[model samples]
Target: AQSVTQPDIHITVSEGASLELRCNYSYGATPYLFWYVQSPGQGLQLLLKYFSGDTLVQGIKGFEAEFKRSQSSFNLRKPSVHWSDAAEYFCAVGARDILTGGGNKLTFGTGTQLKVEL
Candidate 1:
């Protein structure tokens, strides 16, 4: 079974500061990793994803993530945080399978609430 764990339940950072959201996942093999963000009263939006190749992947909104195979971790990072970036971030993992139509099923983490201060 594949599962994701977000160690930090909540994180507070001042505007213009750097941010890093930790994520760890357990899977039988190299699984598809993703980082999503959900603002208050909004739907979940994908921030970044790691399928294959390129350990460091660039994503939207000046965000990036590195896939660490040894650590089973895919941590999201932002060099400069903004007030509008405050949201709940979720880490998800899914297996890719031809039988299951590319393994659409995704198991998400508990999520980390990000709060930005001015």
Candidate 2:
């Protein structure tokens, strides 16, 4: 079974400062990783993903993540953050469950809340 862990439950950053959110996974083989962001009343939006090929992946909203197999990490980073960026961020890993007829599913972290200061 695969799982994800987000070390920090909450993080605060200055409006224009840089930011990085940690995401670590426990999986046997090559894992499919993703980063998503959700606002107060909005659904999860895909930030970035790593399936294969390039280790460094770029995503929407000026976000990017690098997949590090050696470290078992896929950390999200942004050069600068806006006030609107303050939201709940999630790290997820896609896995297949044979118990469920070999269907694909995602294991998500508890999430990390971002609070931006002006």
Candidate 3:
């Protein structure tokens, strides 16, 4: 079975400070990875993805991540985080050969809640 694990249940960061979130996965083959951010009472927005190719991928809102196969990790990083970035972040793994209505399904982590202080 494929699964994703986010070590941090919650994180607090001051406005304009750097941030990093940890993610780990378990899969038989190379798995598709993604990070998403969800604000209060809102749908999730894609942060980044690592399907293949480059080990390092850049995302919107000054966010980026590096895929390390050996470590089974894909960690998200941002040099300066805004108060708007304070939300629930999720790490997800795309199911391979497992499609739901022709599109890949996402299994998300428990989530990491971020609290920002002004």
Candidate 4:
């Protein structure tokens, strides 16, 4: 079964500090990975994604992530986090359906709460 796990339930960082959110996944083969951010009472916004290509991928808002096959991990990072960046971050893993020939579903982790201190 494919699954995603986010170990951190909450994190606090001073504004302008670097942040890293850990994500782990389990899948039979190479899986599509994604990172999303959600503000309070708002829909999720895609941060980044990895299907196949460079291991390190850049995302919006100065965010980036690295996919590690050996470790089954895709961790999200931000060089400098702003107060507005404080929100819920979710990591997801996707698998393509053999019949559909496209990724139709994704398994998301619980999520990590990010708090920024002034």
Root-mean-square deviation per candidate: 1.0, 2.3, 1.9, 0.8
RMSD of 1: 1.0
Q: lDDT of model 2 at residue 2?
A: 92
> All models: lDDT?
0.95, 0.94, 0.91, 0.96
**Candidate 4's residue-wise lDDT over 1-118, tens digit each?**
9999999999999999999999999999889999999999999999999999899999999999999999999999998989999999999999988997988799999999999999
Off by over 4 Å in 3: 98-102
TM-score for each of the candidates: 0.96, 0.92, 0.92, 0.96
lDDT by residue for model 2 (28-53), tens: 88888999999999999999888889
TM-score: the better of candidates 3 and 4? 4
C-alpha positional error of residue 27 in candidate 2 after TM-score superposition, expressed in Å: 0.9
Per residue, candidate 3 scores C-alpha lDDT tens digits across 1-118 of 7789999999999989999999999888888999999999999999998989999999998999999999999999999889889999999988665544333778888999988888
| Shift of residue 94 alpha carbon in model 4, Å | 0.4
Q: How many residue pairs clash in each candidate?
A: 0, 0, 0, 0
Model 3 weakest 10-residue run by lDDT:
95-104
| lDDT for residue 37 in candidate 2, whole number 0-100 | 98
- From the highest lDDT down, the ranking of the candidates is 4, 1, 2, 3
